[model samples]
Target: MIGFSDTSISKIAKRASVSAATIYIYHENNEDLLYKTYLKIKGKMSEKMFQGVDHTRTVYERFEAIIRNYVDFIQSFKDYFLFLEQIMNSPLPQKWC
Candidate 1:
């Protein structure tokens, strides 16, 4: 899901040992799956970003720690970062604004 367009529903289903129809039960289409996956990844990233920084620190300090965490995550997960970067560069619907 992170790699986005390079993969097809059949590929994902086969990789997960499920049928394509089973995937449809959870997502209407590839874009929907991508959106859901993005949310999941973002949540995990945020959790990691806030893992060890002291809450008593200043807002700026905490934000800097988050930036460091974000950079580390991108470096560690280049493919996931690239997929999100591509999606962000893509044209979005007016409703998204």
Candidate 2:
């Protein structure tokens, strides 16, 4: 029941019947939680992409399979993609820019 709102932490706490401080006990901050979520989503995407990739396949076939998997992953996680797009487009964090 994770949500993608600015108040995601608050919503999560409410849904889980816990105080926001309880979440902070596990996560340092909202940014850390977001990073963890991103890592989890990326891991799942990678696992699905590599699920049945054949090492013996032709280079072109393997490349196409990877590309298709990537495209599907992005398509399936459109909200996350949009969040990334917003971050990339924003003028925050000079390192990222």
**Model 1: per-residue lDDT, tens digit, 8-42?**
89998999999999999999987788778877777
Model 2: number of backbone collisions: 0
- Each model's TM-score? 0.73, 0.64
Q: lDDT of candidate 1?
A: 0.79
Q: Assess each prediction's global lDDT (C-alpha) against the native.
A: 0.79, 0.70
Q: How many Å off is the CA of 53 in candidate 1? A: 2.3
lDDT of 1 at 69: 90
Model 1, C-alpha of 16: deviation from truth (Å): 4.2
**Residue pairs with backbone atoms closer than 3 Å in model 2 (clashes):** none
- Per-candidate alpha-carbon RMSD to the true structure: 3.1, 4.2
lDDT of 2 by residue, 1-97 (tens): 2234465677879979999999999898766776666566667778767767788999999988888877787898887666555544544334322
Candidate 1 to truth, TM: 0.73
